[model samples]
Target: MKKLYSHSSFFIFCMLALLLFQSCYKLRGHYGGEQSFEATQRPVQPTDVALPKGYKMEAVATGLTYPTGVTFDDAGNVYVVEAGYSYGEIWTTPRLLKIEPNGQTTQVAAGEKNGPWLGVAYHDGAFFVAEGGTIEGGRILRITPDGEMTRLVENLPSFGDHHTNGPAVGNDGYIYFGQGTATNSGVVGPDNYDYGWLSRKPEFHDIPCEDIVLAGQNFESDNPLTPDSKDKATTGAFLPFGQASQAGQIIKGRIPCSGAVFRIPATGGEMELVAWGFRNPFGLAFSPEGRLFVTDNAYDTRGSRPGYGNGDWLWAVNSGTWYGWPDYSGGDALNTDDYQTNKEDPKFILAKHPAKPPRPVATLGVHSSSNGFSFSSSPAFGYEGQAFIAQFGDMAPEVGRIYGPVGYKVVRVDVKTGVITDFAVNKGKTNGPASQIGGGGIERPIDTEFDPSGQALYVVDFGIMPMTEKGPAPRQATGVLWKITSEGGN
Candidate 1:
């Protein structure tokens, strides 16, 4: 990650301009007013990280660029992935990296595809990568140890606010991945414009995995694509702006649909739907018992269908099942006064339901951004069946207004009882990223994995990417990799 950014004057000027843009909107009261992007003087050592009573955290590697996930090969060599995009419109080449025991890192592979590569996994002799597809489109790629790469699936609808997330290889020898929705809920609104994608991909919109009938719900917003300020567009769910859906209107679904989970042969073949109706199911992993689980990032209080006080979720996957999206959270309908983010209360946009959505395994924070997770299986790990999830934290103002910071820690969840506990976090009185408190601790952890022996857990920390008002000022080479091991009795 060295030489990626030299703290150039041009970058600094851009950040200042971006800061000025965000300051103008602070009077709204609900949007981000003040922020912290200044680099901290205190370098956070592993000892600065807080862990449960009997565990210890150590720094394994540092100075990575937007590192998202980590994996291990058969020989026990460590591998990590760097997501290419930083969301504040910062773009860099996504890379696959191999870490040596001495702490030296080598770039195993670099991507040509549009990025923010969310996750990766090793199956057989190759690595499966989830290309975020922020601009061109989401894709799944198979890469060898020597850097050769091949696309297994392409053209996934992920050019909106979200992207393609997981590539969890199931025991069935098929690669399962999650495709995120484009808009906040369904309708393309001015919020999409703020995300900087709606204008670029004016025709881009969410696609359903199967045929669906709409309830004719539509949202009105000033068209960002049009030059006229007064021109408005009435858009419906799953359709582009200016396109309207009537009552009982049908939208055809295709294979690589948005807001759904799909599977394809590990070697590459026909893509099949495992489940549908997820907002942005970012993380996917299989438990020791073979049950598939995912972490779904709940809706933000933005866009046309924003809902308030909704938390992220963890779900146990079932084939041929429909987990609620847009219409529900935690298996409950969204049309409620409590969930009302704007003037009118939100309501169901679908004409019919496929089936009753199941209850979530557990519920996380409202803006925790609960993401990549792994189940603890080895007895040495102590948690056994519990799952450890990395909360990437929240992006205020961009996502929505916030009273205080949320997430920015690791939590252990008891899948059986649906209970949760903080596992690893920054040493702070306030729950937020290190930048918020000026410490060199876990800033934003994105993903983690237990070693082959299960004696140690490797965490991928997405270093300091703090809110700079309208855009995030993500520092290159700020990412760090951490390891956790049992210290004593638990």
Candidate 2:
């Protein structure tokens, strides 16, 4: 996912000014390390990472290019998606590499010259993949056992930081996936210029009249705003996720082709919306009890539509419920600072939703850039029924100065209590100052999966994305497929 904040050099300067005046910043629980740029210091190999007692880590496959998602076949062969040649530019040639148990590897399928493949899953003799969109829109592609590929869902709205991700198979035998929006929020404004054509697509802005709201100086719409008084140009429409409006009608067809979870039968059928209102829902997993869970990337407080003061979230998904995007963060009203320039702006007032919004089960750190996660169910691994999330870490001067080193390790979330604990770390407690956490520790752990036997986990370490200005700092051919298992087989 491309972050608008990192691209904004001007914002970095402003944040630097703020940092100079501040001293003795108290440590917050959300921060993973000190608020300083860490130089990429060490080579991150399997042996260099730290693990818990009786647990061992080893590199199973090396030399991958920005690998994002991983899965395992019934026979124990590992399949990994290499988000090929990403300079944050969406180009295909992304390959689905199969790493056998014996260490042999081969490309099972390669994406066309388009965008990268962000997610993959193995089910019922086929590999389901989430192909991101740039030249084209995102789609769900299936590679059969013989390597033939077919599209299941095509042309979803994807042209910004977040792409369509995850196609996890649900208990009901449906394949579920998440489609992200074009802009950070509803209207793509001047703050999101780096996205070029994405922020200017008129078709994407089409929404129902009843869903419009008076935002900023006027009712901003994806469609070009007409010059008029705020009171008349946009009368009053429910702000979709419950922003104060003159008209309290709950409407649909808002924010075209974005921020929705969809499901389709394994045999293939029309994709239907399961839920909506996620900023960037990247990871999807199902618990042993068949409940759906998602690891969502929270808002960044930079760019034209920056959201305020809420972290990424882990949600227990329920069908047909809205999870609050543009209007709210983590089920609470989004901070007024996000949209309004003046604190006293009446637009900051809240509105009652036609339906109540759902809250996250657990809150994660802001800009942690969480991606894929899986349920740890095997008792042998000692975290039965917990979700292990791969935090890709933050990569911006603004985030590093404020939130510190947010995410770069695998975190375990207790399903029952929503309590989160660090299950695996690169170097305990001292994750930031940037230099101390890289090279040897997990630089950017992107995805986690359980082995077929459920005795170990396969972690995809997306090598060397430091939380600094010149970040997205890739350690070429440094991506590794790691195996986390108990020492001496427990």
Candidate 3:
């Protein structure tokens, strides 16, 4: 066992430690928070990551910052989006780069100096991007081969922990993407405001706001409410949405904007809502069968409105269907351990909701923060037709550090039964007992892309932070590109 540090001080130490070792799976002990452990120094080489018996993994490039989206052009060049902003620092424009077979990386476009970009895709000599967390709000922009940029959508409510993500092109000549919620669990309270960068705005800012769903009927304090607690139960109703306004007052079925999925036709027009009820949907992809699938980031039990997350999920997305949020987790009725109950009963919200959202096809590990995903099409990889998702892992455990280091690797899901199986693992520094949780060498994988010939799979590693850190380090020039293939064959 190692020493433990208080969460407050540990966050500060991690922020300042640039060359910190990766400890993605080390468990935190329940003590008085007097002792803390640090990872021993080790070089992060291609060999640090592990693959199954017949597979091999290696680094293609390194030294990028906070890379997220990955895609390939017709010319065999790899394009990646480096999210420019550090969590708590000044906004820096993210970059789109073109990488060649020789490992040379060239900048394609720096969308904006102060805004961050999360998702990207290549289509007909152009690159589409999802620019998030800006004064202008989340929007999808298109970049020409020569680097000219044009905004496709704008004024999206972009704040809180998640942002607008994805821009994959569908076979029907439509561009699909995801829009995340503005507040955690549909409430902008003090916990969100404390993050400082979060704008504390309501999630739904568009039409169809007329009959949104609500969780609790009235505001009740799990802890003492303060002026900073901007929850609708504390502050007057949020603009253009909240039906009632009053501190500790009761209101009928709450109306809130949950996370959603949207699509824009290739011919170009308005962005249409395809599905709703996600918390923080981070990744989207279509299977070889032409079915759409998505990876959603679930809720946290430490927020202002605390509740146990059933787990993150991979859903076989359906148009015009509800997937359950605020009132549900992982398709089951949401746990109401901390809110005020109404006559309709807090427990039955899931049963009574008219839309009756469908459950996930597969349940990911709790707090795994599942991100990008893609379907295996090439017979060379052996798992053709299976879907692969990047479990980016969780940071800042809720309460007593319960679910730290649950993700951090790639997983393969059975399309037929929705069963999840580990495809990659990182045994960390010592290969200690905790290493079974998959951390250390692999770090945080953000997106998975397969080569045109299907002989190779590309993975974007978003670097590694100490599992104990509250969030990602402001800036670490450690992003890497990993290629995975069969060792004996392929």
| Model 1 lDDT, residue 224, Cα | 74
Candidate 2 C-alpha lDDT tens digits along 146-179 = 6888998887776555678897998788899987
lDDT of each: 0.86, 0.67, 0.66
Extract clashing residue pairs from model 3: 3-35, 3-36, 4-35, 4-36, 93-113, 214-254, 428-440
Q: Which tens-of-lDDT digit does each residue in 282-309 have in candidate 1? A: 9998998999999999988888777888
- Give Cα distance to truth, residue 270, candidate 1, Å: 1.1
Models sorted by lDDT, best on top: 1, 2, 3
Give the local distance difference test score of model 1.
0.86
TM-score of 3: 0.80
Error of 2 at 484 (Å): 0.6
Which segments of model 1 are wrong by more than 4 Å? 1-42
TM-scores for every candidate against the unseen true structure: 0.91, 0.79, 0.80
In candidate 2, which residue pairs get closer than 3 Å at backbone N, Cα or C atoms, i.e. clash? Answer: 38-434, 38-435, 42-439, 43-439, 44-439, 92-114, 236-246, 236-247
